[model samples]
Target: MVEVDNATLIAFTVLALLAFVVALIFTGLSVAKKSKLFVNTIGEVSAKYETDITPATYAFGIWNLIFIWQAAWLLYAFGSIWRYADGGPVLMKPDILPIEFYLFWISCCLLYIGWLFLWDREYLFYAFIDLFLLTGCGYAAVAYQSIALNNNMIGLMSKSPVDVTLVYVLVQNGTDLFFSWTTVATLLNLASALANDPLLKRNLSAKSASTISLVILGIMVLSWSLIENTVWFDYFKYVYAWYAVLLWALIAVIVKNYDRTNYNSVFSIVLLCLVVIALVVKVAVYASRIS
Candidate 1:
């Protein structure tokens, strides 16, 4: 309901898009700066603290897909802006979007950059809070989109599903995809933090470490089950790729670290079984969605 004139909207949109580019650059820098030898240069820096929930480095290659889609969305937005200069009445509509949308979106972008810095610095607790804020703003955008989906600006209104516009495809669907992955990313990152906090690893006994990991896994599965029955049930499918990535990470850890000389095979086996079951559920849900 916040009306934005053509000139103001164009300026704001361009600025926010630039901010996203900057944040992405910083993230890419962090990735590039990671320790080639040991990978301890970045945050969460300890081999011993790694957990089954942490995805292998290659799993993050999904960023390529995310980046391409984001670039396409930005290009489409610029095209919409150009329409206003063609004597079109600012092309003012939900598709072009109001000021409030940009505000929430820019906040998400900013929070992500901040979150990255905190995460890279190994501030696990603060990074968790940052992820909460980042994801909260993202979900807020989703809520706004749901309301505006049926609004007259886009004018598909109640017929959104059947007669979707390009705006719906790029803007609306883009938001959904970004949010879906971030939701999973946040949880996986959080679980990794819990399992690999350096201080805890130094202080806790071997048995305690295994016990804590199991507790964390149990809580995550319980949380997943609760969400499964809710309106957000689709979240499970969104998380499937992450579970698959984690499976790979777990398998790698077992290959490299699971030995009687250093680790408990019984605990490792139990851990593997738990994650495998979770991955199976995630795969099943994802497949069902495709079907």
Candidate 2:
């Protein structure tokens, strides 16, 4: 086994904590800005660029749950670091938050902060770019977490069923949930950015752009489901929180545009149904493997 020095692990722990603090600070600032504390809300800015696929206002409520779950995991990670710092036994080889995890998580947090600024300033295209980066980082972090979990690294640290469940809920599921939401957010950003472009607007109708974007997102989600089933099934067995969140977001879109006289609205519901079908197939595949 490769040995990790105490100092390096502690340093990452400190960095993780600092990065998380900055993320939360920016999150608060973004909220304040949205409240018109200093500028118009994100929703207000986003409303200006509304596309046919834009989810209902209520869809954004998922952010509350996302943040809460993320906070829980980071705090759990914090506690794990504290245990290590206080001379508690190293719960596992390496550490819960590996260097890769730190790199991805820190980068994700920083990029998200940057994305928020660009979004608030109405830099829709640039904001989408930053959001794309943020989503990449989030997915990378989740991938690393999945690797660790599949190797039973997290399970090693557990002392009881509750402990293991906490890791499953607050770490594994939490990371995946964040990534999944960011995936949805990235689609929204792309659609909005395209819709907001004067050049694109003159060339393409909003409904056309939205329909094309929705189709792309649906294909992406379907491809991801296939990958999860074939490659990451062992790593993510029985973990459906990400799917649930995605389904919810898709349902939100359907709810918002269900009555709209646009083909994009029909496309949105079709995408949701496709996602549901994929999820069912994935579950069945996993079930067969276990049985």
Candidate 3:
């Protein structure tokens, strides 16, 4: 392990805390913006289809709750890292506690513990409970989109300013879909890692897609972990650099074949690039501080 002075550790801790706060603020602003846009989009769609609608009943309302839940986890995880760096004990230990354990207990307590209830009631319910959690998250995301459409109808009728709302709705809904697809990709990767049955042929047959998706997810997780677990930042830095190139190549493909109908694909590519850019910027800032 690399040794660092107390002062440097404290500085890193402070930086991490600041970054987390900024991210939280941006996330909130994004949510508000998306909410407005969602309402407006519903209005446009309803108008185009010549149907009566109300924004108050937008499906995105559920998304507001889901985003809040995710934001809480982001805050807790960031706060935990800050505390540890600033002379506090670690909040979680990965070796002693599995990734699923932290994911269940700290990040998603309800789902984690809920699975236990099902497990005891029916021991062989499913070989992997994680898959169920994955499915639940996906379902929640879809429900959020549905709610967004409902609430959007209400916003549409008001005839209020919708420029900001449009932008927010576009980005938020687009990103929500992107995240949903990523969740699907993650579950597939997880299945490939853990599943042993030959009957599940689809998972085995798409080895190339699974491998690519896993590499992308691994890079993303590692990049975020670098900031959260300062001890491994250097190691992750190397991974980020290589992955950046691969991500850009993917972005190029999307851009080259740009189509308005393919918005979801474009959005996914753009979000992936944004994530890579964020990681690169973080790595550069840390490198400058060390130098």
Judging by lDDT against the true structure, name the best candidate. Answer: 2
In candidate 2, the residue pairs with backbone N, CA or C atoms under 3 Å apart (3 or more residues apart, or in different chains) clash, namely: 34-41
In the range 175-205, model 2's lDDT, one tens digit per residue, is 7888788888887887877767543435356
TM-score of every model versus the real structure: 0.63, 0.88, 0.25
Clashes of each: 0, 1, 21
Our model 3 lands, by Cα RMSD against the true structure, at 23.0
lDDT of 1 by residue, 163-233 (tens): 24555566666765666556656655565565555644444443444445545655765565446535554
| Local accuracy by lDDT, each model | 0.59, 0.75, 0.38
Candidate 1, RMSD to the unseen true structure: 6.5
Model 3 is weakest, by summed lDDT over 10 consecutive residues, at 46-55
Better of 1 and 2 by lDDT: 2
